[model samples]
Target: MPRFRLLPDEQLARSPLSQLWREFARQHSAVAGLILFTAFFALAILAPLITPHGPYWQNDALLLLPPSWSELGLVQYPLGTDDLGRDLFSRILVGARYTFGIAVITVIGALLMGLLLGTLAGMSRGVKSSVFNHILDLALTIPSLLLAIIIVAILGPGLLNTTWAIMLALLPQFVHGIRNAIAEQLSQDYVIAYRLDGANNWQIFSRIVIPNIWEKLTLMATMALSTAILDIAALGFLGLGAQAPSAEWGAIIADSLDLIYIAPAGVAIPGLLIFLAVLSVNLVGDGLRTAAKKRREN
Candidate 1:
């Protein structure tokens, strides 16, 4: 008998992955969002090289100057200085690192924790599943922002604590979603066939279930990213997260509000960045949904 390779031929070629990318790229809005998002991060990474001065470097002489192009503004102060005279453009570039980085980390932690617990809950039934489901439902019933606030209040405010708080706030949704998807997959004929072929539960889960659910997980993660970023921003704005002198979008916005009438762009610039970032993330989620439309139809 011709023997099968231990690894399937499909593993040697990325046809499915390539097809998925082709579909994702076909979405013009998503593609545009991705391009802008990529540019944002690229600027973040190149901040040191591109920024004219350190983000924290202040010039008391230039306090509250408008955009350089504005007749009142100086050429050296392009977008102008905040009330404290910190460079607005440089600050925003650096803030991108903190604002986007923390959100991604918190969401990743939630995803991993959810995967471990959800897999166990979904693979088994009866009392254990019941217990997990009830707990998840209870957690989900609470609004996530409120849950985040509670966690932050309990832990005291700091960068690490804020990340953990966001992760905890987002955990239930991931767990519930993964659990439902896995339970649904477990009932399919393919799983039964795998059992008949003498594949153990672990093998079936790793080889079949995970591959099938990857798309949904990716979709959810994209959406969750926007939520995480927004929550982090809210916490910072409320003075419970990134504190003064830290280049975080929310902190910048919070601090700039007092100067809104003096330099409306000071408040507008950072706020617009946050809005654009979240919008682009949602666009990516839309792309994922479009890619999966056919699968849903089937």
Candidate 2:
């Protein structure tokens, strides 16, 4: 009845998830990214409760106030005020909803649609597959931001429309990635074995194909989410995404450009937030990709 403890290798060998987690943790930047992303997500979810002032609330007396740390600044408005007298800190906290939340939802929709369409395209042969691949290639040639802009133009401005536009733009990439992963997975000898063992196409796809290609799919999803966030922010900056009074990060940056010289922090802080969010997502995705590759090699 003496106590026993498993070694690191023993633990990893006993649990695939533990192995993956270990590999992921080896990347320090990715761990930091995960922490930053969690904080941003929490801010987005708890903005209403945590924010000192309403995102849209205005006080003429507080217009263009400097940060609280500044000599001229007031403690009440920590990050200071925008030209419209709205609280910058409050706006940033709330902006996470549009910047991160909508992008997440859009990426989820794109991945879902891509899985179905890509599976169909991957499973098809001759003319059907060829035609679909050609269409995907054509779509891939367009930059995501440009494609989103076109879609938003047709759908008109606002957060809802921008989300849809980003989704549509992202769909082609997801479809292409999924289709390729499926095709590659299907070429494995195990798939032929499954067919010979009397497995139906649906069963083989849902069980064998999906399980085998899950790592690649997950990597694609993480990368796609970062793209979606950037597209949403760019559209908002261009005045084609979230409308005024929304406090979306990109919109906040756009509204503060004129004040950059006078109130540099107003512009720099929001841009810095966007930079951090995108960097965090990319670092996490890169870490996942590296971990998956190492796992496969092992």
Candidate 3:
């Protein structure tokens, strides 16, 4: 008797990103989040070309027209018109650029800064580590929003300053998290082996530690992104970020507060988008973490 042989086809080689994408795609919530996340960025990036009316264009006659779906709403303004007759749809579209764009900048800045400090702290002994730890503790104690508010206060309000403020506020969490991961990685047998082979700190870190902790960094970065968005929104709501006619979600909602009775959709739409955007990032981040944990186990 003869047994059938397994198929001869070779399994395709995959990179970590490809593997992570496959894993994230396998998760139902993650797939949905990815779709929404993609759509959100797409909308933001394409706002200028796609939006029917100028975000700042005003017409008193068209002011406060409810969503087309409403009884008296105009069909042309699907989401509705705001108090100033600017298209709520267009403004929200443009707002995505300010909201998500700033979030991206803040997350990236925080990531780089955190990774640098954490690496320094992790690699060093005594004073260097102690100083970083103390700073981390101090940062952790002060609330992130409060920290951002203080930074903005010092820098004065503007887009660049606001982005930096958000980044600074989020930096401590990254520093602490990355430092711990690096410290643990450095304690492993491979690292000790590399050291025995006369590897310098940079060599070991570049060759071993980074490869190992890369997944963890991605997870941390994704988590930080959600926090960044919330902070940016809070700043905009408090008049500390993108000023009038700029159309950030929180700013839009803040501006629309007076018209809550007549056009609550203005408030509700931006609020819903913020909720959806945060939820999407969180779900995707969770998926990445679940995938990472499973990988580590195997």
Top candidate on lDDT is 2
What is the C-alpha local distance difference test score of each model? 0.86, 0.89, 0.87
lDDT tens readout by residue for model 2, 148-204:
999998999999999889999999999999999999888889899989999999998
Model 2 CA lDDT for position 48:
83
True-structure lDDT of candidate 2: 0.89
Residue pairs whose backbone atoms clash in candidate 1: none
Clashes of each: 0, 0, 0
User: Candidate 2: misplaced stretches above 4 Å?
Assistant: 1-13
Question: Which regions of candidate 1 fall more than 4 Å away from where they truly are?
Answer: 1-14, 295-298
TM-score of each: 0.91, 0.95, 0.93
For all predictions, the C-alpha RMSD in Å is 5.0, 4.3, 3.6
Candidate numbers, best TM-score first, in rank order:
2, 3, 1
Point out the higher-scoring one by lDDT: 2 or 3. Answer: 2
| lDDT tens digits, residue span 191-222, model 1 | 99989999998998999999999998988898
Q: Residues 183-261, candidate 3, lDDT per residue (tens digit)? A: 9999999889889999998899898989988888988988988888888888899999878878999999999988899
